[model samples]
Target: MSASGAKTNLHEFVVQENEQVAEGLWRMRCNTALAAELAPGQFVQVSVPADASHILRIPLSFARADARSGELDIVYAVVGEGTRRLSAMAVGQASTMVGPCGNGWWLPQDQGRALLVAGGVGLPPIFACASMLAQTGVGFDVVVGAQTASRHCVGYVDELRSMGIHEGCDCARKVVLTTDDGTLGMRGFVTQAMENLLAEHTYAQVYACGPNPMMAGVAKLSMSKDIACEVSLERMMGCGFGACSCCNVALVDGTQALCCTDGPVFDARRVQWQTR
Candidate 1:
């Protein structure tokens, strides 16, 4: 079930624009009603057209959703056959998608600035989270990372910077870009930038989406500081809903939860990072 208490449904979507945004990364805009229903951190299961034999849908999270425009932007990496096929889809092509799946990021319980960390394609949800914060008059700082300069999305960074200028927002926002190969702003992991920020300033909450190891590191740092943190986890889902049970997330409580339904977003402390 979605946060709005509605059962997931198949929605028809038309591709508006599908083009390469960064090396090996493609940004796609789709016209669909699902845009209004989606919350930050939630994902959609899209059935790639022209592949009746391939039953599995590609699960993707959106970078932006404009309810008025009835459009959503998805930033995806061309990793395998499914995504490669998705990249080939032409503008005006129509397809079916199941959404708005899973829970989304929750606002911080206490009032203070928050920190956002994103790596690679993880930038989408993190960008969405920043938008949510901006709309609610919450202040935030961002750290975006990629393997190298070519893999980074400068457009999202610019969008994040613009959030600092929101009408009611009074606090200054800091946006940091990091690349492992030292080809960009900072040379090192997002964690390294996060560490420096944590040391210099205090934050009420932290939000992150990235590879397991990177998120684990973020969770550890947040826990040590006694700060609340939320992380969006990625899993392979045969069924985007709960039926297949392929996307199990091990919790610290010795139980397993389905990532597709229970969460793609979860409390950082509750997850068993070792299992990931």
Candidate 2:
């Protein structure tokens, strides 16, 4: 891995495994030398080679990366033809990827309590952050929400629970699962779950990745509670690099930034949703 903050180049990865983890969600693991440098919240743009009509690559956040093993995994929902093509790929398939794009979640120096909020496909980067936090002594909690338990829940929750048990840490015990149908967890949104957590304990910061409304709700809640919060922004990209101006987002400061290069992550308080 390069030194911290060093730029990474595009690299072709060999698909090692691809499988459906949920109803429409698939997790793909690739072997790449770039995996050694990818951080939580950083993403890769994958080319949909199987579909000739789709010229643009789809952006996906890192679900897990092992520097030692040179392996990186991405979990995504097959929502379109582009992703459907990715889902149908076989092991040993080759995919061209340009990544560790944008910024990742910033970890606090002190080992204070942290809160992570994720919904649907947004769970990938949050899951990666959880793995990083688990290695530290930082106390943390995760609020995972989806439309339904059977179809929407990301399958890594069990693995996280097992990790907590093996490590003997309480981090995994605090995972709060919520669903609209209440099939497996609280019958409400993840923001409601955050409300419950905030009522019980104080956190150093909150990190969120999800739908716009969901993330905006988390941001509102964090602002009301005076807790620092950062959100990962999702936008369309003609080019994963800053050359394309397709992913511009307005900031509270009356300027615009590119989600591709400037950030897929931004301070929730500074983002001007009105301008979007």
* Deviation (Å) of 239 in candidate 1: 0.5
| Residue 191 error, candidate 1, Å | 0.6
Error in Å for residue 62 of model 1: 0.6
What residue pairs clash in candidate 2, if any at all? none
Per-residue error at 40 for model 2, in Å?
0.8
Per-prediction TM-score: 0.97, 0.93
Which regions in candidate 2 have their CA more than 4 angstroms from the true location? 1-4, 164-172, 274-276
lDDT of 1 by residue, 18-44 (tens): 999999999999999988888898999
Error of 1 at 17 (Å): 0.4
lDDT of 2 by residue, 1-276 (tens): 222364757788999999988878889989998788787888888886765878888988988899999999899898988988998888998878877788888886656788999988888888888887777656688899988887564458876555435554455458889998889789999999999999999888898999988998999999999888889999888888888799998898899999988788888988887524
Residue 78, candidate 2: Cα error in Å is: 0.7
